[model samples]
Target: MTGVPKILMTLGAIIFVVGFLMQFIHIGRLPGDIIVKKGNTTVYFPIVTSILVSIILSAIFYFLGKFR
Candidate 1:
């Protein structure tokens, strides 16, 4: 019960910080990300960013599980 709220608060704070940093960081433009542009059209995909985030989250959860 108490742990639930603590976990929620920590997650919320992490999300907030990530969101704030994203405003100034070009995370979507990292290497291995895809970008297509035509005269008046553009498409973007953050492949590397997705993988990096996935790896980070997986590690975080793995360690948390280990501790528990």
Candidate 2:
């Protein structure tokens, strides 16, 4: 049907927009050191590292998808 192409295009456009937004969603960012000290115990939270990992992974996915 003639409507099929139009429907598919619309869905593709929606997927593009959603994927674009996802590129900006910071899954990990620090407000501050993610731990506190009451004079004992030391801990750490990995936020910046995760952001970097996400970026690398996204880039790889983007390129692989393109080459296909």
Candidate 3:
């Protein structure tokens, strides 16, 4: 295949693998993520998870570009 279809297939595979692994690995609850609780209110933020995802995506795109 060429261009968009190929890229879409690769991304779909990557997402599938990540989703499968998430069944056994709790990704959003990483230590560096933030959580706050007060009285009857609680808040959660996946800062570390977002950063990790950004880095992973950057690496994947970089390699994909190299191959192009």
Error of 1 at 4 (Å): 4.5
Each prediction's Cα lDDT score?
A: 0.91, 0.74, 0.91
Which portions of model 1 miss their true places by more than 4 Å?
Answer: 1-4, 23-25
The sequence of per-residue lDDT tens digits that candidate 2 reaches over residues 20-58 is 977998544465426655668756776676676689879
Q: What is the TM-score of each candidate against the true structure?
A: 0.75, 0.41, 0.71
Which residue ranges in model 3 land beyond 4 Å of their true spot? 1-9
* Clash count of each predicted structure: 0, 0, 0
Question: In candidate 3, what are the lDDT values of residues 1-68, reduced to their tens digit?
Answer: 46899879988998999899989988787989999999999999999999998998899889989998
Which residue pairs collide, candidate 3?
none
TM accuracy, model 2: 0.41
Instruction: Flag the better candidate by TM-score, 2 or 3.
Output: 3
Write down the worst ten-residue block by lDDT for model 3: 1-10
C-alpha lDDT (0 to 100) for residue 28 of candidate 2: 46
Better of 2 and 3 by lDDT: 3
